[model samples]
Target: MMLLDLFAVIAAAVLSVRGAPALTQDPQAAERPTAGVFVATDLNWGGDTLWIPDASNGSCIVLPAPFYQGTSSFGPDKGIACSLWYHDDCDSRNPSFGPLRTPGVSTQADWSNATYNPNSIDNNGIAPNSWDKQVTAFNCWNVGEDGLHID
Candidate 1:
């Protein structure tokens, strides 16, 4: 009986190990956005580079560089010092919405043109000017190769 129990345990362990790979690989199995999926930039002020994902709200998944906190036209410098200029979707109510669907690099200009720009900003340094200076997108993904997904 003890031997039979040991064999059952071993079989369970083997099955678990075999199943582990399937679970782990499931995310990759799904069609994921490739690297450099989208680009992000500031709209109101041209050349004010925006990262792909905004780390402030814990939404971004990638970025180009480690965002730095520096004083700028926006308020006190803190958090990932970049705009959340673009995303895959327009509606914030949905989790999967972002910029992937939108062709071309996501830019502040695109965000500014959106109807929902005003309510997106919290007056924080990162999203300082929702009315005048729009940053962030509804469905955008991060492109930072380093995997620095958050601020």
Candidate 2:
């Protein structure tokens, strides 16, 4: 029927829109120019992007299956970085999730001060010897005023 054809067309359009780079933003962070986190599926900031809308206030986040170890970038600050761990270290926040590995961290592979911009502190997560394909759970915090990285 003609109605069925119209429904199919509408559905196709909606699906196409979903494929675009969607910014699932949080209104609180939207006010700040540099607030959320950007995790990409490939190095050099290429490929699919997973945006964490609330990286400024400190919290633990477990990367969904699509973004595991893909690589990450913080808000527009060279000093801002996320503490990345190889296994699921967010047990309290994510009680149901199991560790992807043995639930530990390799300092060489897990970068605590991981920034997209390569710096002297080994901040780059996408580097050859960094957390490129190994990150699972990460802790994000405000730039300063922090006793702990994640809360």
lDDT winner: 2
Q: Tell me the tens digit of each residue's lDDT in model 2 across 1-151.
A: 9999999899889656544243333212333455555665554344565556565454667777567755543222222345555556643322121121111222333334333333223322344345445667766554433333333
TM-score of 1: 0.25
Tell me model 2's lDDT, rounded to 2 decimals: 0.46
Q: Which 10 successive residues of model 1 have the least lDDT summed? A: 68-77
Clashes of each: 20, 0
- Model 1, runs deviating above 4 Å: 1-36, 40-59, 66-100, 104-111, 115-117, 125-151
